[model samples]
Target: MADILLTAVINKFVEIGGNLLFQGGGDLYWFKDDIDWLQREMRHIRAYIDDAKDKATGGDLRVKNLLKDIQELAGDAEDLLDEFLPKFQQSNKCKGAICREFAMQIEKIKKRVDDIDHVRKTYNIIDTSNNNNDCIPLDRRRLFLYAGETEVIGLDDDFNMLQDKLLDQDLPYGVVSIVGMPGLGKTTLAKKLYRHVRDQFECSGLVYVSQQPREREILLDIAKQVGVTEEERKDNLEDNLKSLLKKKRYVILLDDIWDVEIWDYLKLYLPECDSKIGSRIILTSRNSNIGRYVGGGTSLHVLQPLDSKNSFELFTDKIFHFDNNDWANASPNLVNIGRDIVGRCGGIPLAIVVTAGMLRARERTEHAWKRVLERMGHKIHDGCAKVLALSYNDLPIASRPCFLYFGLYPEDHEIRAFDLKNMWIAEKLIVVNSGNRREAEDLAEDVLYDLISRNLIQVAKRTYNGRISSCRIHDLLHSL
Candidate 1:
């Protein structure tokens, strides 16, 4: 709540300050002192804003009120610039006149800052200077490996088989697809295998091709990643990409593919012939139809849910964090409750992970864990929404809108990252990082990756050069 609002305000302040300092140029250079002061003061206030956000999450009313006032003050500052900048630009010989025009308003701006400072001091809002504790920083290259280490269980055989298939020289240039229902970790396994085998290729890239495939963009990405350079021209993207990879041994990973048509389009650029040694196309799809369509016979690997033993390992590890002493000392009644909860997870990796996260945040009591187990019904009766909601609740307040925006799309819709970046900006949903000169779209991409790291959304497709081409929201998350 209040944290989201304050974060939005801080982003706006930084955006406006950046525009004034850089884009204002000589037209308003006389106000350098004012701009510098504003920037410095804004930077100073940022620490307190973050501190208040942490405290505000605990439901502190005073901190909430302070955040509201700070948001208003930030809005006022932006309004002053919005009004003054355009008028100044429209006027002839306006530099001196603009400085004079903003003279009084500058004082008002400083006074607002002072008022906010007074409020910060009065409330005893100490700058703890801690970053958002909720967002777990993720490295893209190591995402699946991290999941495997922390949450994945009993996939050694699956991993070995997939790895063997990828390395088999007999099928140097062909498609390998992974098919399964949602939450079965198809994307996770694909990622792990891709990272493992990619180094062996001359050029390797992973792209996400979601339900709604953008043929031109995807082809262009593949071309770029495989070492092809193209200008603004779009006349022969597929042909150009094909020609580039025609002689090279390349590996490409496509994730969350929803249609055979997507592969058919991408296949135009990718060489799928016996001549291309060590080149492979690996993909993951939820639809079994897509698997049959792309690789007609025996090429699809149908992912299975964790078996009972593996499920228990994952559940207990999440609940107890591998503390053998803790598990050993537990009462028989509590141990039974643990088994009941794991049983209710129904061997689904996602269900176990979400349940564990929720309970781990609660009091470690038999009664508390049992209550969760009871609420979480068996098999289909276990509402996927409830499990997802627990995961959603764990996200930083600043990250929620970015995750919820997925709900706006139709079920099974494939969302393009470029379109999503603009949409996030148009909706004013993303918070810009201070001192970050990257475009707003880049910041939005960062937010998307954060969601991906939290397993909230799957990377549906990426470009050959390692940029996210498209994404897919879990159908259950769409219900949320």
Candidate 2:
């Protein structure tokens, strides 16, 4: 009787692949049990491969061949199970939910495989691969909807200030710095200004120099933005940049700069335009000192958080999908709770977007709103901190402390790369190579660039010497 029951279960699974297992609501628990069995089988297959590798360490050719054959069979079985397991047992009712979960799991598996493959391919695992060399330039021609319609949200007045500086042919060398907290919309404002007046300048370019700012990568980015061919970059990077921008009225936007040294290197390439020929450098940073260092008080625009109405509107757009009527008609208690939740977001656009996304998926009920309000603090922390943490977690373990070290700096404090890297070396966060600390320092900078790219840190400004003079975190983000 037990054997017959087992045979019936196996046949059911084979016949319907478990899709109908829950349909009749009869003994669906066996479906999970069967999937677990397959998982156990995969584990055993992996163990066999490990055993074979250990036994063949003496270079036994026949054993090695036999092990390879067994490994291939195990791999095929694993692959077959992987293909059928989801179809057989997992919930297929919600495509979006299932696909998202599957994608995340697959991504984890892919990263693990890639890491193992990298180890197999290279005898030494160097941290140099963490650099932004793989970073690709965003399409400047494509309009980003993050900014939304200009009529709904008024233009940031700073855009006009940058436009004036960029178009002023009589101004010899002008540097404009847009100072703001993270998600207060520095990049959005810069993009708006760039889109509006990019054509006015003889040459225009925008490069997002994320936290792990690389001079070579930045120069390469500039080269690409201004139409410098791959062949030109193959030649001297600096020389190619100088040749491309010299004597042209150019508007170069160095977005999210972290290292003042980037400014130092970039300045060498920028033409020293006379009063008759103008060149503009617009930068965005969360640190005021960065603004002072980069802009020298001449062209600095400080961005303030939005007012209650704007903040509410931003939140509403994200949560209610711009259906203001639905939100307005919601129960007064529910609406108040929602408003309170938005207030905690501190007018940070990213925070608002993340929080509102969570709320949007939930039912519009008093109980639901209260639940969100009750957990508002934790939610805000996760939203702000986790975005930054994603970049930190992605970093190699060796470079992780280099990032956490930034926590020592007070919120909104400007950080200089030279002093920071030296501190990292002193604290033993950096690794030295061949009596040259350059590689270690370079890696540290890459870590910084990674943070900046992830929007955790903001580039303040570049000094006259062309290095990142300062950096700061958004206050709300820093609180996280």
Return the top candidate by TM-score.
Answer: 2
Every model's TM-score: 0.48, 0.51
- Writing each residue's lDDT as its tens digit, candidate 1 over 210-312 gives 4345677667667777777655236566666777678788888887775567777677667774463657888887655566677665667877668889988
Against the reference, the lDDT scores of all candidates come to 0.68, 0.60
Candidate 1: worst 10 consecutive residues by lDDT?
Answer: 137-146
State model 1's lDDT: 0.68
List the lowest-lDDT window of 10 residues for candidate 2.
1-10
Task: Evaluate model 2: give its lDDT.
Answer: 0.60
- In model 2, state the lDDT of residue 171: 42
In Å, residue 111's CA in model 1 sits off its true spot by: 62
Cα deviation at 82, candidate 1, in Å, is 66
Cα error, candidate 2, residue 39 (Å): 49
